[model samples]
Target chain A: GQQVMQIPQYQHVQEGEDFTTYCNSSTTLSNIQWYKQRPGGHPVFLIQLVKSGEVKKQKRLTFQFGEAKKNSSLHITATQTTDVGTYFCAGGLQAGTALIFGKGTTLSVSS
Target chain B: DTAVSQTPKYLVTQMGNDKSIKCEQNLGHDTMYWYKQDSKKFLKIMFSYNNKELIINETVPNRFSPKSPDKAHLNLHINSLELGDSAVYFCASSHRQSYQETQYFGPGTRLLVL
Candidate 1:
């Protein structure tokens, strides 16, 4: 069975600080997707990485995919109170397969 | 308009009762999925349907049955619900059944079994 693992099950940071969450998969993934869930809200899709060693940025957030396609990372610069939420990483094995989501990293930012 | 929607944003029932959660997608996606998020926030996929056909069925209990009435609707029925069944259930849809596709999730249905 394929499994996706995320580190820092919980992270608390102050405003203007940086935060990062790492994800690793037990098996090589065809693609990886990132999601964010705010308090009492549903998960929202943020970005996806399919190519190896790929790096994508969205404003102050940066996403990186490992060369082996088995790991990924999300980094946020100068975190704000609006950035408080749980970040999840989901890995897909192949076409038509359900994604395996890692235990999300919950981020809490205090001003 | 909501891309994906589910009925009964919250459900509270006693153990041994039966309940159903309904999901509909207006994104014209061929694939729909149901995932459960436990208290620990571990998200696990329970079932998936593509074009009204069952595609992925995980190792979930038989008491948990998923019905796909049409390509745009997927419903989940739980029988003899237990206390352990308390969790947030989410419905999501993707443009296709491919792994590379991004999924759009609906506001989850929170179920609590007493």
Candidate 2:
């Protein structure tokens, strides 16, 4: 069975501080996608990474895929209240297969 | 217009009753999926439909059935629901054109079984 796990299931940070969540897997992933879910809301797609050692930045957020494609990390440069939500990392089992999502890392930014 | 939509945004019913959640996507994607998010916030895939054909069926109970009348619509029916059936169910769709399949999700339908 392919399972994805995330570190720091819960995290709280000041508005100006930084935050990060790491994801690890036991098997190599063909591709990885990150999603964010607001409180009492559905999951929203953020970005996807396919190449190994890939790093992408979107405004204050940075996403990195490990060289082995079995681990990933999401870093928030400067956290804001708007960034408060749970971050999930999902990996596809194979081509044309369902994705397995991680337990998710909940981020709470307090002013 | 929303790309993906589901009916009955909220449902509360008694145990042993049957209920169904309907979903439709306007993106014209060839693949659709049904997922369950438990209290722990773990998203699990229960079913996947590729071009109206059942492709993936996890260890979901047989009481749960999914029907896809066409590529634009897929519905889920639960029979004799139990307490464990109370959770938020989400419908998602993705195009099969490439390997990087980015899924578009709809606002989930919350089900509460008492």
TM-score winner:
1
lDDT of 2 at A30: 87
Question: What digit string (tens of lDDT, one per residue) describes model 1 on residues A1-111?
Answer: 778999999999999999999999878998899999998999999999999999999999999999999999999999999999999999999865788899999999999
Off by over 4 Å in 2: B97-99
Position B12, candidate 2: lDDT: 99
Q: Name the weakest run of 10 consecutive residues (lDDT summed) in model 2 chain B.
A: B96-105
> Model 1 Cα displacement at A13 (Å)?
0.5
Which pairs of residues clash in candidate 1, taking residues 3 or more apart in a chain or in different chains? none
Reference contacts recovered by each candidate, as fractions?
A: 0.95, 0.68
Tens-digit lDDT string for candidate 2 (A1-111): 879889999999999999999999999988899999999988999999989999999999999999999999999988999999999999875775678889999999999
- Give lDDT tens digits, candidate 1, residues B14-84: 99999999999999999999999999888889999999999999999999999998999999999999999
